[model samples]
Target: MGLKLSGNKGQQSHRLVIFAAIIVLMTLLILYGSNNVNDAVYAPFHVATNYAIKATDLKKWSGKDGYVPFHGNKTMNLQCHNCALVTSSSHVLGTRAGKEIDSTECVIRMNDAPTLGYETDVGNKTSLRVIAHSSVFRVVRRPNEYLQRPDSNPVIIFWGPPNKIGKEAKGTLYRLIQRISMTYSNLSCFSITANKMRKFDSLFHRETGRDRQKSHSWLSTGWFTMVIAIEICDNIKVYGMVPPNHCGKSKPGSKKMPYHYYKPRGPEECVTYLQNEGGRRGNHHRFITEKQVFSRWAKQYNITFTHPNW
Candidate 1:
């Protein structure tokens, strides 16, 4: 016997079916849709995080003029994880920190400082060199000693006024450096341009209220080296550097040290600094004043002075 359902019964059955379908849909959404939604929300965040990291890292080596080659147009960023700035001061004479300094990723030295004779005090690794215009003569005079390195040839950067090291300028020093580069193809020689030097002057003035030209204080090679190190190094440890108040801390009848580690019996380091600090500003290097600035910078940046740690 065929029977037709009443309208109320049919309606209740349809409602039950609809409720079951709704429950299935919700279940599927809970399992699958939530993950899809989370992925959609997280992709942008992942990309943004990487972008932030890259930006902060670039800030470490940006805005400053990079290490420029003397022969080519290609500029180098000169980045290092650990940098050891081995100064020319005599404070390193007895530190016995050569192994520790050489252990760093890069070892930076100033003009014509020989590591062979004093390897015990100054490490024999020269990953980079920053030389003054005046010291160009010493370097070229002993090309075999300073220019060529059997183990590794570190890049050399000669900083000077434009008239002395400029491309168009003519002088014995300029010609000699150019000739040296041509002869030692392995040697990577770089020069600081006129514009870069002026930028450095402006930096010094900004750090110290006095105008560099008006103050008549030439920026020391240590100043240049420290500035560049700040730009490129992730962490810097200055060896044999002294604090600004170091001179004041000296006691009467205290033992003395040479002006340079290489010159054992030369002028005393503290005595020279005191003389320059008080001398006519016409041609002096205000070493004490520069150290004061450097101390502030060390606190500001990733620099630390060792061999009398600051």
Candidate 2:
């Protein structure tokens, strides 16, 4: 089934039928298939987020340059039938979608959103985490929470402007992250090269028909996550990203949720989002504009949205 069996009774029955059909297909394949066999793919295996890397692949990045480990070693192997890209938006609150998000083959989270206290809403399992360079400090601030992943190996990809991530440049965040990777041997970290960053800028230009540099628009972390998802996964389900007009809709006196579920009092989600949309800051992320692009992507590819279901 494209989605999980968390709907009404009739929907459950329909999903049961689909389940039975899939079983039959698998059974027949096992009985009569050739020596070469392939993994069964569900309908949602279209796009995925979060690059899943393991500590075992760290000989120092030798292959692909898109995502080389913190040691600069290897490109992570991505295999997922369905992926869930969980956001930090407060819209995820009270949804109780933890079970559904965990049901996917891979769960990818952004930055350092914790699942410890909010396990009822956000799942505990994480296959990969895509991080923003500016948010690196937050993850390292609490080593006990983020880096000490004994139960699972989650790959982390850090993205930012070239000057900020370059070795010779003044990007102390990347240097700090490199130190953290060495300190925590169990953690596997990856970094997108400057070339890849330019490619993403090209992609943005292609999609929006505007030069990113001229626009003075800094790409959002969500944007990077989406690009990574499209490259690796066959399907993707995005959570907590509000639609483009969600803030503009005339819903009188609606409670404005916080920008991030983890930060309840920091900044209201829609207000900051509106500022991003208006391009108020010199290098601000175009949150609403990014959603518009995401909407187009959902139509063009196997992408879906939840938590206010776009």
Per-model TM values vs. the true structure: 0.77, 0.76
How would you encode candidate 2's per-residue C-alpha lDDT over 44-128 as one tens digit per residue?
1111234221221112212345775666554578667799989999989898999998888899999989988887788888888
Clashes of each: 0, 13
Pairs of colliding residues, candidate 1: none
Worst window of 10 by summed lDDT in candidate 1: 45-54
lDDT for predicted candidate 1 compared with the true structure? 0.77
Error of 1 at 176 (Å): 0.8
Off by over 4 Å in 1: 1-67
Residue 285's lDDT in candidate 1: 76
lDDT of each: 0.77, 0.76
The alpha-carbon deviation from the true structure for residue 155 of candidate 2, after best TM-score superposition, in angstroms, is 0.4
